[model samples]
Target: MALPTHFDSLYIGGSWVKPIGGETSAVINPATEEVIGKAPVGTGADADAAIAAARDAFDHGPWPKMAWRERAGVLQQLHDALMTRKEEIVQLCVAEAGSIVPVASIMQFDMAMDGLQYYIHQIERREFVTPSSVSAHTNWATGGETLGSTVKVYEPLGVSVGITAYNYPFFLNLAKLGPALASGCTFILKPAPQTPLEALILGDIASEVGLPPGVFSIVTGGADVGEKLTTDPRVDQISFTGSDKIGAMIQAQAAPTLKRVTLELGGKSAMIVCEDADLEQAAFAGLINLTNQCGQGCVLQTRQLVHNAIKGQYIEMLKAMASQVKLGNPADPDTGMGPLISAAQRERVLAFIEQGKADGNTLVCGGTIPPGMDSGFFIEPTIFDCPNNSTAIAQEEIFGPVVCVIGFDTEEEAIAIANDSQYGLSGGVFSQDPGKAYRIGMKMRTGGVLINGGGGRLNPSVPFGGYKRSGIGREYGEEGLNEYLEIKVIDFRAA
Candidate 1:
């Protein structure tokens, strides 16, 4: 299962084509700091070509006109094709996205496949057409009588462009791709420049699965390429997963065309440890932000709101668990954590560590590069005991293996602290009483909440997104499928 050394072409119009500018960028292995490959760097011309192809496909393509079952058959073929190459895909993710084996295998690969399957299942059950009750009204003044029946039709929104983040390339791509394709929208993907290899491979998969021309395309490049796609009038919708700043920019860029936008932005989510919670389980679950994808996940609970009753014991357990996490090469099967996406990302996390120090937060452990790990963008799992939830470390998304432990005096205080941030993406509440946990979870101003780790599983059937500034629109489940669809009402009159 050797990975491809180079991705030298963009996949557009269901064919492998060279970039219009003929420029390429080196793909670096974040864990090793070595050039793993060179991916084609697309430009505005490339984006225009992709968007045009997608527009043409949506305008006059068999895919959108095909029966839902027929489309499901094609998606089923894609899922099987991806499954056959799962191992190779995981390895490529490790090389390209700095994802450790478990994270790459489970979070990046398996979860994506599951999401695609969920969409396929939904396609079978979803009814795109709904009939309304027929009514009759008479105007006495004109002596006019009318009887009519109306039907609401959900149709594809035409061409959709998905701009994904670097942390979970494959997962995020499918998070957007599954819904767009399931709802019969032609898709164009612009992956993060740092991790385009896996996405290029996805293009290969889509081509091999016999996806119709213009139904799918992948154009890889920097922000300029994204701007081209967002500003273009032909693209009917934009699904972007990245920082809030960039999400705002994309929203603004798409305003003139009035294209629909679904933004899955950043999060500074919290984990509340209730006074009656299981301290051991709570501590282990709290380490998820530090271990999984090295805390690069937007929804990872980076803010820990522990009750003052068990704060000391919980902090000690967290320290012990954090220390045991093995950080090194992502390819290692036993490694619990890996490096940040790049040196720049490592520097950013380090700067936040310094800021935490300046803000007078207690540095519990790990604030520097790990010993004997100098060749890669590796940082030790850093933890802070903050006085309040107002510190920079507690509020902003660090996107690295950093956690802030904030003490709360009561349950009400915990809920207030968790909802006190600008972000409301995901959070968790741990308690011995299920009713208590549910009560607190419902009060939190976030989109998703986990009780007792929700058995440490992610259900694709559940809608995943954010509230407030965290994001707009949702992904996964029926809500995700609706994002790519537009409604049309038809009225029929009988004489």
Candidate 2:
């Protein structure tokens, strides 16, 4: 398929319209750091228009009044349309964001489709505008005679702003938007500049699937645009996924206006490899999970807390497995990994590695850019033997393919090291002892924990969010849908 080089304007109110003052950003293909395409650069005014449109739809337009069956039908149609264009979506993601083709095709696309389908499946289970349950018909009081009343209500939270990170654009969007849509809220989606094409394509597909005017919109730009979207009071809620630093800024700015905010922020997750674990299998799986998506994923387990007795063996196996990560063009079907999002990102990762060295960590495997792929924003699948939980490499979210190995003496110490972080999102434990693994997973204080190979189902039927600054609200479940709803108790006198 021949890729288009540019999109003229933001998609809004069911139409591609010109912004009052729109700019443009050249979307770079990280694999080559080459400007492959351009996305519309939206300003505050653009955000204003999109937000207003969304607000109108969510509050007073057809979307708010649309029956649940209609919304479900549209959602299913969108799902089918997206399914038909799965290959194209993968291609665009690979080109726009340096996403690995195999992973994008296998995990990202299919899972997004699954989430959409799940949302469709939910329409049957939902009862719009439910009333409070009542058993006794007569008025009753404890000691004194009193009148009984009933309550019933539910409605949309007006417009919502959705901001996605560089990794898993489709997956995250569905997780955020699906529930909002189910609640009858309209959306203004801002895909990461690194991967806006897929989102733009998502909006287009949604439109084709007969999503109503002003029901869904997309404005693509960089930080400035994101700030405008988050700051606008017309936006009922801001759902963001990215760094902690940025999430803080959003929270601070949003506080004055008291915007409803949900931030899925940064993490330096720990992968605990216990004594009785399959060292080789664990090591290889760990390497893949850490380095996948070029380590752009915020939940990527960048820290490995290994047992002292088997630390050396785990390190050796991890080194060999890290060597197997082949980074190249995203178009290559066999490529397991790709490049970072930009030259600046690659430099940042390198600086972190240097800081690790200064902090007295040993470079076990890849420390430099891979031998031959020097032109692109490429960093090796690097690992450092820091062994100290507080080391710079061990604690910081490198946001690159860099893993730090730390040795723990006992089970208590391993759990201690795992919990010693400001952010807790996702974690994994590898132990032959299922009981121990389960116990550790429970005690580890994260949104999700895996006994062995931790995986994110993100089923639309299941809730997903993090704790302690990882995020404010859950997504992809019944609870997620409620975030977009306002509960009202209609007092009905029961005589």
Candidate 3:
């Protein structure tokens, strides 16, 4: 596939625009360490323009005033447009982000389409206003009885900024954009510098779809652009997906304006393998997902908690599976994993591996760069036997293809270890006894739990968020839409 070397302009206020800044950022291909594309670096002026445009749209444009069905129709058109470009988008994602073909096609491409379509479906059947039951209340001013009725209405929260991660750029953008736009909120999208090309394509599609000017915008830059969007009072809300470190910064920046923020941050999720569990299935599932997106995902189960009795057997199964995984070119159908977003990210993961080794944790198979494939920012699928749960490698969120197997004596210990971390995004349990697994899952402190290998996969119809530092608000489904809406209550009394 031929990649565009230069996107000469950024998309703002529904138009192809020249960025205020002359500097540009190169979008490097992690697989080959080549500059696949370059996006015009956005400046504070660019962010101001985008935010002002969104604010204008929300305050006075036709988008917020349009009926629910009218907005739903536009969402349907956007969904159709995305469906038509499925192949091109998938190929672009693979080229720019080093997403292995199989995973990219489903996650970065197909699921994004599904998410937009899900929002469209939601609004098509949605009720914008609901009537509350009538009740009688004392009229204090008149000193008389009054019969009253109330109606509740949902309204958009004005301008929203979506700061997405590099791992799943397109999906995260759509995850926030689709619902926010569908809910009548004007939006400014800021894609991560590591993978910004595909998101730039989204701006093209939005324009081609004839979305109202100033209703949607995409700004491409580093932390400064994001900071400008977060601190500016014009931006009414922020939906961010990335590390906890940045999420905290966003929360702090939005504090002065009290902007509503929905954050999907990092996770050190656990996959508990019980004594009676299908050892091979549970272990393999955990390992495969651990390397999914080269372990860039926030929701993957990185902490494998196996009962002490079956730890050896489970570790062996993971090793066997890890050996068979092909880790070369992402375009190859047989390749199971790909490089991290950049050399910097690969080094970060490698540093964590070195730390694990220094801590005397058992290195179970990977943990080094694969032989002969030295050009790409690649790290082997690494695992460690971390006996102490308090160890840095065991406790921290190493956003890479690394897993730690912590042995637990009982279900209580397994739950305790899983919930011990500050993160509470998603978790899973494996056991032959469904009831036992269910009981354990219920006790977990995480926001979402899987019983018998049932979670981790995205279900657009349900809510997805975290507890503790994992995140503040939910994304996907009705919960996601609600994040962009505000409630208003109106009372009617007999006159």
| lDDT tens digits, residue span 1-495, model 2 | 343557867898889986667567788888877777777877767777887788777667887777888878778777777777777777877877778886787667887777777766776567756666544443454454445566657777878888888877877777677777867789989888777777776666777778788889988866777888877778778888888888899898788888888888888888899999988868976787667889888777888899989999888988887787778988888787888888888899999999999999998877788878867788888888885888778878889998988999888898999999887888889999999999989889788787788554444577777777677777777777777787887776554
Candidate number of the best lDDT: 1
Candidate 2 residue 444 Cα shift, in angstroms, is: 0.7
Per-model TM-score on C-alpha atoms: 0.97, 0.94, 0.98
Question: On residues 1-495, what C-alpha lDDT tens digit does candidate 3 reach at each position?
Answer: 333447979889999789987778777889998887788899989999999889998899999999888899988888898888788788878878889997789988888888888898888898879998888878989988899998999998899999999998888889999989999999999998888887888877787678999999999888889999999988889999999999999999999999999999999899899999998789878777668999999888999999999999999889889888889779888889998888888888999999999998999989999999978888899989888688788888888999999999988889899999989998999999999999999999898988876854578999899999999989887998999999999989854
* Full candidate order by lDDT, most accurate first: 1, 3, 2
lDDT of every model, 2 decimals: 0.91, 0.80, 0.88
Q: How big is the positional error of residue 184 in model 3, measured in Å on the Cα after superposition?
A: 0.5
Task: Compute the lDDT for candidate 3.
Answer: 0.88
